[model samples]
Target: MGNINPSLLHVGSTLGAVFMALMVIFIRLKASARPVTLRKIWIPPLGMSTGFAMFVVPEVRFPWWWAVTAFLIGWFIFAYPLMRSTVFEERDGLIYAQRSKSFAFILLGLLLIRTVLHEFINRYVSIPQSGGLFFILAFGMILHWRVYMYKRYTRMALPKAPIPQPRG
Candidate 1:
C-alpha cells in the first residue's frame, strides 16, 4: 500500500468527492449559524471534517477487499440512512443534514472506486488512484456524518419532547 496525495488527482476528476465535501461544509455552516434553536449543531460538521481530514493520513498496507469491506460497513452504519432522510426544519441553527449526505456518499464512492480500480481495473482503465491509511479514516468520517444526521433524523422522527411552541 502507498500514500496518495489528493492533490495528485485533478480537482475535476474527483468532482463527486469534492462536491460532497463542500456540501457537507456548506450545510453545516448554514445549519449551525442560523437563528434556529438546534439542540446540537456540532454533530454534522464534525463528521464532515473527520472524513475530509482522512485524505492525508499516513500509509498502511492492507488487502484490497479489506478496504472496501471497511468502507461499506461504515456506510451501512452511518452514510446510507443519513442520505435517505430529508430535512424539513432545524430546531437549532443547523443546516439540513441530508443535503450534506451526498458528500459522504461521494467520498465513500471515491474510496471504493479507487480501491477496486487499483486492484482490478488499473490494468485497463488507465486512471490515477489514492490509497492507504487515509481510507480507513475517510470511511469512519463517512459514518460519523451519518451518525450526525441520524441523530437529527431520529430526534425528528421519534420525539416526545414537547415541541416548545415558539415564543412570538
Candidate 2:
C-alpha cells in the first residue's frame, strides 16, 4: 500500500462513509418492517464486537485512557439520541419499533459530527489509530443503544396483567 495516494484515500473513505450511511438507513427500514425480537435487538452489537480484532494491529493501538475516554463519550453522549429515537410498541400482540420522525436527521447529524471529528483526530494520529479510536467509540454507542433496545423489547414483549374489575 506504499503506492496509495492520499487524495484517493480521502475520496475512498468518503464514499465508504456514504455507502455505510445508506446501508444503515436501509437496514433500519427493513428492521422496522418486521416484528421486533430479542434476536434482532442483540445481533448488531454482537456482530460489531468482531471489529475489535483490529486492535491487534500495532498501528491501531491507543492508550488505555484514550480508549476509555472515547468509549465513555460514545456511551454517555452519542447513545442518548439513539435511545430516545428508538421506541418499541406492542402491536397486535407483537412488538414493533415505532418510527421516529427525527431518526434520519439524528443519524445524519451523528455522521457529520463523526466526520468532522475524524478529520480533527487524524491530524493528531495515524489513520489506523484514528479508525480504532472511532471504532471503540462506535462500539460503545452501539452497545449501550442495543442494551436499551433489548430492555425495551423485553418490556414490550412481556404479557400484561389484566386490570381488576370494580364490584358494584
- Using TM-score as the measure, which candidate wins? 2
Number of clashes found in candidate 1: 10
Best by lDDT: 2
Q: After superposition, how far is residue 143 of candidate 2 from its true place, in Å?
A: 0.6
Model 2 error, position 5 (Å): 2.6
Candidate 1: minimum summed lDDT over ten consecutive residues — where? 124-133
Over 4 Å off in model 2, which ranges?
161-168
Residue 2 of model 1 has an lDDT of 44
Clashes of 2: 0
In model 2, residue pairs whose N, Cα or C atoms come closer than 3 Å (at least 3 residues apart or on different chains), thus clashing, are: none
| C-alpha positional error of residue 50 in candidate 1 after TM-score superposition, expressed in Å | 20
* Per-prediction tally of clashes: 10, 0
The whole-model lDDT of each prediction reads 0.50, 0.86
In model 1, what is the error at residue 127, expressed in angstroms?
8.8
Q: Against the hidden true structure, what lDDT does model 1 obtain?
A: 0.50
